[model samples]
Every structure is written in structure tokens, then in C-alpha cells.
Target: MTPHYTESSLRQPRTPHIRMPPFTGKEGWETWRAQFEAIANRYGWDEEERLNQPRLEGAAAQFVFSQLSPMC
Candidate 1:
């Protein structure tokens, strides 16, 4: 005997998709940060919590370092 699957089960469930708007300058970064903070808040995440952990010193640090890197 084979297990049965419902049409709904076979179909992917719909989920809310949140995307940040494009940034053009310092204002853009602030806008993006606001959206990020909102999403974090929705999931009960504290932006400051990560600060409690040891600072990243390798490839992991680049994630944030690159974001703040000066542009040409």
C-alpha cells in the first residue's frame, strides 16, 4: 500500500514575503535599517543581543564590516 497526499499538502503554502526597498544614500541605509528592525521585532529579536556575544574576528566579521565599508 502507498501513502496518500492531499492536493493542498502537495502544494506549497502561501507565506508573507517581506522585502526591503532599494537604498540610494545615507537616508537609504536608515530606511533599510528601519525595515530590518521591524522584521526583527516581528520575530521577537533584539538587535542588541548579538552585542553580548564575542566580536566576530574572521569571515563572519566581514558581513558587517563590508556593509559599512567606504564607497569609491
Candidate 2:
């Protein structure tokens, strides 16, 4: 006889729907990073290192954020 599966074990994890929020011009990276840091803090994430990481400079940040946000 087959064993019955419990609801918790049978359920699949939900995928989050990532939204691409608006970036604020040239200062957008700073703004985005600040907002992201705030959210990370709220969730008890490691905000310090994340914000301090060496990121791609200037327009590269914009390009990367746009590409990654949709997949988040």
C-alpha cells in the first residue's frame, strides 16, 4: 500500500514575483541601494556587507540592476 503524503511535504515552495521599481536618474544606484538596504534590515539580512560591496561603476550599475531586478 502507498503511504499518504502530508500537505506540508507535498506543497511546493512559492516563487516571489519580482517587480522592477523605478530608478531615480544618475543618483538611482544610491537610491536603489538605500531602499534595498532598508528592506534587508527589516528582514534581518546582512545589510552592512551587501551595501559595502564594490559594485560596477556608473551606467554599469543601471544596466545590472535592470537585468537582475526582473529575475529577483
Total clashing pairs for each candidate: 0, 0
Q: What would the TM-scores of all predictions be? A: 0.30, 0.32
Poorest lDDT segment (10 consecutive residues) of candidate 1: 49-58
Specify the poorest-scoring 10-residue window by lDDT in model 2.
12-21
lDDT of 1 by residue, 1-72 (tens): 999999988754232344444333434455656776676557554445322222344444565568677553
Give the TM-score comparing model 2 with the true structure, all chains together: 0.32
Provide the lDDT at 52 for model 2: 38
Q: Write the per-residue lDDT of candidate 2 for residues 1-72, one digit (tens) a residue.
A: 999899997753232332334444556577777876665555454545444334465566677767676643
